[model samples]
Target: MKCPKCGKWSLMKFYICKNCGYKIDIKFEELVKRLTSENDDIFVSGMRDACSYTHSNKFYGVYAMEEAIKRKAKSENIDFYEPGFTYRSGIEYAEARSELLSLARKKGFLADVHLTQELISIWLAMYTHLDFNDLAEEIIEISKGLDEIHNFQLLYNQMHDTAVLNNNDVQRE
Candidate 1:
């Protein structure tokens, strides 16, 4: 396909234009879904590994925790943006969290409800960090106002807990 911005003929299916640095044929929604799915898987896998290591080796647990946090931050940042800019940020995060919860249940880790809660909280905090109060409030309002919205309360609660935890952590350290 030819580049939209630049009339360049290339064999690449979807990519930034080589000639004029313009984007080629691509679907933004599809890209977001694909990325969110991949990131969710990575975050879940990292969390599982981190939890497994927590009992045997503190250092490995810490490392895995850090990696999980990084992955979560990246996923949240990519998925959470202006409403018109992206459509599936909150949905993706919620879906990912649900999947993680299922996995945790299967692995006998869901009994620690607090851990799951903390994970969601951390994700919200990271998301809010990327998007300040104004954007966050806008996003929340939009989510709440939408009739089709799901898990709005869950995400909001998580965000609240995240803020509290973050403040406490900062005070402690």
Candidate 2:
């Protein structure tokens, strides 16, 4: 079941959420697994949160992304019922997707994450503004592990593109 507190799916035996501790007396991890195995609304919720958080975090990229997504969706004649994706669009989704992943990234979620070419491209686009040195050690570790652990060769290759991932881009690490 969706944890009322953290909104994550939990194992039937798991009374506490790993992401955010929320205990429900109900034994329901199996149900959570079954539904989330296919899909879940939490992804959508996180998407919306990403948009709002990005807008609040300060910058216009998310806003611009929002417009771009809206235009693309419209051009493609893809109708969206959810406001989070359609209303917020690019900026918010990007921001939310990344931001929601911040903790996961820090905790090496990318290792467990199914890395794809699309994901690498998105990170490259979003983090092109980021410098290699500015990256957290954990982030660096994850980057390196992308190939070693996950065998994400596409991601590994793109990560070497100095134009986007570099040491001098942000003046931090």
Highest lDDT model number: 1
User: Using Cα atoms with residue i matched to residue i, what is each candidate's TM-score against the true structure?
Assistant: 0.21, 0.23
Task: Count clashing residue pairs per candidate.
Answer: 0, 14
- Return the lDDT, model 2, position 139: 48
Model 1, span 123-162: residue lDDT tens: 4543655443443344335434321111222233333433
Location of the lowest summed lDDT over 10 successive residues in candidate 1: 76-85
lDDT tens readout by residue for model 2, 59-173: 2222222322333223323221111112334765366435424633454333322233234444444464353234434444655432222222212322332222233342211
